[model samples]
Each structure stands twice: as structure tokens, then as C-alpha cells.
Target: MANIPVIAIVDDDEAVRTSLASLVRSIGYEASTYESGIDFLNRQSEDPSCMIVDVQMPVMTGDELQARLVEAGRRFPIIFMTAFPTDAVRQRVLAAGAHCCLSKPTGGDEIIRCLEEAMAGHAAQ
Candidate 1:
């Protein structure tokens, strides 16, 4: 049997993690939730197909996590969500090769679309 693709959701907010996990599962992907970037790094048993990360996480911010992953040569597609969206932050992540950076309260449909796009791009790589 084929292995299902996993999508990791990393956020300090429990509610955000739960809701995003449900959405990811609903759209036919396995979902993993982590309360922080450090938690994810220490606990992830397998590399996820993609990551949905919050930019302003407490311990390890999304940018820091992205940097660490890149330094380790793990280029899993990343879709960042930030409560405080700014052009600078978005551009920085984009320049660092993030799939996209989304604003909080983002709709389920938009998240799905971004997920599909990110997965498609990763598949083509």
C-alpha cells in the first residue's frame, strides 16, 4: 500500500493546531501537530510532505525553523501563517523559498488551495 503524505502543523496555539489538523485530514492527508518548532524537530519521526507553520511562534519562529531546515538540507515545502502579516515578513519567507505566507483567520478553502499548490510544486521537483 502507498504511504499517505503527511502535513505537519506547527503552532503555539492549540486551537489553531487542532483546527488545521482536522482540515488537513478532511482533505485526505495525514496530519501531525506540534506546539512549537522545537517540539517538531525533536519529535518528528518522518519528514512531512509539507509544513504549515506560524510565523510568530514563541521559542523558534517560523523563519528560524525554515533556516534550520534549509541548513540541514531539508527543503520541505513550507506554508507560513502569521497573525501579524507584513510585507517584509512575507517577502522574506518567499525569498527564502517558502511556498507562501498566509495571514491568520485564513479560510479553509485558501489553505486547501495553497496546500494543493505547494504539493504540486514539490511533486514536480
Candidate 2:
């Protein structure tokens, strides 16, 4: 893979997707924005270096996407962001090997940190 990583931002809200993609791009990653998990699933080419997805979406939730990927025997680091944060959600995603669960209005530094952490872990393996 090339050193410059691809970071996918999946969210149903247009503004959220746009802002996050812009932030990712500003951080120097090749960014792709998707309106839903299913859209990403259908269109994703090579697996992204890191995935930033919203916890709640219209058709497909981020957790559902994670499950589907796992069912397909695929492993990748996911960073889930949500306006509503819960202990249960945190536990589940963490147990499933997600990179982090961040609350919305999350800082750009934090997002970048999580992406770097996710890629670092992947690289170690």
C-alpha cells in the first residue's frame, strides 16, 4: 500500500460528512465521504487505512457495518463518533477491536490521533 492513507468518513448527515471529509483532507489523508455504511460497503475499493463512521445513521448503523465486515472475515480499525454516547455502545465497539468511540463535536486533533493510532496498530500487525 502507498504511505498516504485513505480515510473514509461515513455519515448520513450531509454537513457532518462534508466537514469530516474536509478535516481528514486537511490532515493530509486521501478522504472519501459516504452517506451511509451500505454505500461505503458497495463502493469501497481497497480497504481504507482508517474508517470514521457515525454511530447512528438512517439505513445502516456503524455497528452494523462493523458486524458485516467481521462476518465477511475482514478486520479493520473503526473510529465511531456519535452525538449520543453510551457505555454499552462503547463496550461493544471496544470489544470488537474498534480504535475509539468519540462523541460528536470531537476535536480535529483527537480524530487525527485516532486515525494515526488505528493505522499504527494495523502497521504493527
Score every model by TM-score. Answer: 0.96, 0.94
- In candidate 2, the residue pairs with backbone N, CA or C atoms under 3 Å apart (3 or more residues apart, or in different chains) clash, namely none
Give the per-residue lDDT digits (tens) of candidate 2, residues 20-105.
98988887888989999889989996788889999988878999999998888777789999999999999998888788999998
Q: After superposing candidate 1, which stretches have Cα over 4 Å from the reference?
A: none
Q: Give candidate 2's error at residue 62 in angstroms.
A: 0.7
User: What's the residue-level lDDT of 74 in candidate 2?
Assistant: 74
On the 0 to 100 scale, the lDDT of residue 111 in model 2 is: 86
List where candidate 2 sits over 4 angstroms from the true fold: none
Candidate 1 per-residue C-alpha lDDT over 30-110 given as tens digits, one digit per residue, 9 for 90 to 100: 999999999999998677999999999887899999998898888789999999999999999999999999999999999
Give the whole-model CA lDDT for all candidates, comma-separated.
0.93, 0.89
